[model samples]
Target: MAVKPNQTTILLILRIFQSLFAVLVLALSSFVAHWYNTTTVVSSPSQINFLIFIAIFSILSVTSLVILPRVFSNRAVANPYILLGIEIKNVLFWFAGWVALAVFLSRLLFCRGSVCHAAQADVAFAAMAWICWAGSAGIAAVGVFKGVKKSSGNNVEVPSGGVKPEAVEKEAV
Candidate 1:
């Protein structure tokens, strides 16, 4: 199926924002974790580490999805089902990562200093990143559903008389 130019442009814009938000989350979370490890006796919270992991994973996966199709121009790389699957996976992971980070931040009795502020910013960016991913997944889901509908519509059956629908319509005319 041919992709419309506008749809391609919109998806590209959404992906760019997703990448930017992921990078921002990564930077903030890393700063917070490093600050905790170097200045304080306690280790950084597990949520921060998970956020880092999600950011890294998103960056790598999104990069590959964007570049691989252009580089190889392979039909498999451009398959809508595969694209939908990856988008859905990212959506779920991003959702979990941000929620976990928010919960961890809420449990803190006092959040002060630059590190605390950075952690708060990380939560905000993580949530934004999740939104971007969800948008991508929604677009992919629509494309997949449309493709399924089109394929099914093409397979309409005739009656036992073997009269084509088009032929019946022409006879009526």
Candidate 2:
């Protein structure tokens, strides 16, 4: 049987995922920074990096997709739309920035002394980087879509066919 999640439970899940992803992103960045700084000594990072990257990149995207629309609609606290019309746009932009940051950091970590890709490097790193980048872009795009949809005030649904003026006036109260 399917069980419904309570409101606080849902927010807790979202915050947990965001926190986990943020930690992973920061940790990966530090590791990458150190790895490239000392690439001449260490051949490659352990397989654990690959696993962590995959876990983080995939999990981080859920909040961008799930939490944003609710916030816009005032289903969640701190409605971005209620306070400022531009808040949604700002959030979307930041989402893109996060993705770009992750991609740039991952590329630097793997390529280590060049802006170019290396054929000799581990293919998993390359794949993870691209997927994370593309996924992040997708997430940001979804936020943009939400911002547009909500800003236009399009959530008010019409009945299956149409509502007559008398019925609408009666329902308005």
Candidate 3:
């Protein structure tokens, strides 16, 4: 029988995919930016620069979130709320970056070169990265909600000026 992977394993896989997509976006956007800088009178578009920034930020964020915990087993890197917040922000940044790049590409009247193709690939990879971030955010949100519910349900009510039953029992013994 094959062993089924748990939620943590699935989340780790998703993070790996997110990292790969971010790397691809970084490389492709860097290529297009360099091409424009060297070959064209106009500088690289602002959208490309934005994508580059997003890619670098995503790579660093994922590295810190996923890898740091393993390397430093004793230290707690971040709480669940912080992780969810970062995932949400990444989703928004990636969405804006890819949409801006797509718009810039669409505005070009005549795009028929390697640089143009590279830009198109960059947009695709950015979109994929956005999807991954969104997925991660959704998962994180669910986990946070579940944790809240579990903690709340475990609360034990005590009467006024009275200790918990377990505490009273321990004192009596």
Candidate 4:
């Protein structure tokens, strides 16, 4: 369910710009992480590689955020599945994925490179991840709900000068 190119140009541009910004953020974070990697650890896990770990996750985040969305938006793809469409559904799914990635990254940051003490957090990562994942799924799921039926059962309500469904029904009767 890809949208025509003519209709999606603006959306595509906006998405590209967003991707660029995200990648830039990851790049800056990577620089910081690399700097962190050069420092000595004072804890039991003297062999810790926190910077490398963050760098890997940053790469993964950038891939999921930028590359996946572009792939989903491209019209050349032949997948016709409604759930995987490039319309509102795909956008929502992409948005959710981005949000989840952000939450995960934030949790990583909260750990502050102390792998052994990461589990001590009370309400940062645990609750945030669930909230992000569920919210995303709900938004994309609405598209599925819309596809279930073309229209709602309610009749259209028109203004005084407009054609009225009730009057039309009376005339037909």
Off by over 4 Å in 2: 38-94, 97-173
Ranked by TM-score, the better of candidates 1 and 2 is 1
lDDT of 4: 0.38
Residues 128-164 of candidate 3 have per-residue lDDT tens digits of 9999899878877887665433122337642222234
The predicted structure with the larger lDDT, 1 or 3, is 3
- lDDT per residue for candidate 4 within 140-167, as digits (tens), equals 3453444533222455432212234445
Note each model's CA RMSD in angstroms.
9.8, 11.6, 8.7, 13.9
lDDT of each: 0.80, 0.42, 0.81, 0.38
lDDT of 2: 0.42
Top TM-score model? 3
Q: Residue-wise lDDT of candidate 1 within 85-110, one digit each (tens)? A: 88888889888988998898899899
Candidate rank order under lDDT: 3, 1, 2, 4
In model 1, which runs have C-alpha deviations exceeding 4 angstroms? 1-5, 148-173
Q: Which 10-residue window in model 2 sums to the lowest lDDT?
A: 115-124
In model 4, the clashing pairs are none
**Highest-lDDT candidate:** 3
TM-score of 2: 0.32
What would the TM-scores of all predictions be? 0.78, 0.32, 0.79, 0.31
Instruction: Give the runs in model 3 whose Cα sits over 4 Å from its true position.
Output: 68-77, 148-173
Return the TM-score for candidate 4, rounded to 2 decimals: 0.31
